[model samples]
Target: MIDIHSHILPFMDDGAADYDAALGMAQDALNDGISTVVATPHHANGVYMNPAGEIEESVRVLNAKLQEAGNPLLVLPGQEIRIYGDLLDDLERGQLLSLAGSRYILLEMPSSRVPRSMEETCHELIIQGYVPVIAHPERNAEVAEDPSRLVRLIELGALGQLTAQSVAGTFGSKLQKLSLELCRRQAVHIIASDAHDQLHRPFGLSEAYGVVKRELGSDAFDFFQQNSRKIITNEEVIRANPVQSYNKRHRLFGIFSRKG
Candidate 1:
């Protein structure tokens, strides 16, 4: 399996602080059945800004360690890019990291507020031929309050990726419910372990898949996994399932606690 989001780059960001922790995270990913991981250290996230070039170098070094350790899992160059007006410029200038160096970039909106310019930004990114993968919308407070904003982002041709912990109910019952609701409405395109370590943010994409399997079915599980592979390969992503929209009222219902 391919884990499209992870902060495993050692001493780079809020992920691993050294090589020992990074190796531990890699081992955890392997145990979870993930064979590949995109080392998505936070980029342009103010406090922890990792550049595109640095990300490539980071992958190179980590791969060397993996090879030495005989670890089967592979690390890829990528970033959890923070949004700004200059996205297209940087992308055109070859200053971005995609998952596995594919055309699909993991783009981040502010956790505090869902970007109001998300629609236009995504449309522009698509026009530029780079697929923007919106990171962890289920955890965003604005979108939690009003999922219609997320619905609109999906409509504008951006794909949403849900965090594994969100599905496992790590953030809270509210986020877990929201994450499942996103799946039910087909608002989410992929499920990834946004793992930061072996403890708090453990590598557990399979466990997340289990939750998705129980909530949706084998079909939904395969749909996300298959398309996630396509995204990393730089291939055209087949939606697998038809694009489904949610009723506005359902968004409000999703914000509250889950009875079941």
Candidate 2:
């Protein structure tokens, strides 16, 4: 499996502290059936600033270490950029990194509220032929309060990615329910382990896939898995029509089925 988001690069941001910790995290991911991990360190998020060039160098160093250790896992360069007004300018300046050098850009928003410029930003990104994928929208308070906000973003051609731990109930039961709700609404397109460390945030992609298969069925599992592969290859992902008017009474009605 391909995990499209992670912070396993040592000394990059708040992820693994050192090479020892990063190697351990890579082993954990390997045990979880993940074969490729995109090292997405925080970029321009106030606390951290990982430029595209730096991230590429970091990924190369990590991959070299993994190779020396005889680990088969592949590490790709990426960045989890916090949305800001100067985002487009930064991208044009080649300071931002897209996922696996694909057209898909991993984007993060404030957990407290959706940005007022989100719609415009997403629109602008789409116009530039770049897909902005909002990371962990299920955990965002604004999205949890009203899922339609996420639906609106999806309609604007933005995608949503759910953190694996959120889907596996690691954060809490409430967030797990919301994660499943977003899945049912077709608002989320990918599942990734936004793993920081083995203890606090471990790799839960496999567990989350199991939950999706059991609760939503195997079709939903395949959908997310296939989308992850498509994203790294810069292919167009199949987006099901999101249920705009989410009804609690019909929670199980729209779980994803095989699209092709």
Best by lDDT, which number? 2
Total clashing residue pairs per candidate?
0, 0
Give the Å shift of residue 156 in candidate 1.
1.2
Q: Native-vs-model 2 lDDT?
A: 0.91
Candidate 1 ranges with C-alpha deviation above 4 Å:
240-260
Poorly placed runs, candidate 2 (over 4 Å): 244-260
For residues 1-260, could you state the per-residue lDDT of candidate 1 as single tens digits? Answer: 98899999998888988998999999999998998888899977778768788889988999999899999889988899899877777877777777887878899999889877777888888887778899999988888888878887777778889999899787788888889877766678888998888899887899888877777667678877887788778887754222332325454333221323
Clashes of 2: 0
lDDT of 2 by residue, 180-259 (tens): 88888889999999999999999879999988888888878989999999999889987877764433434535555322
Candidate 2, run of 10 with poorest lDDT: 251-260
Per-prediction CA RMSD (Å): 4.3, 3.2
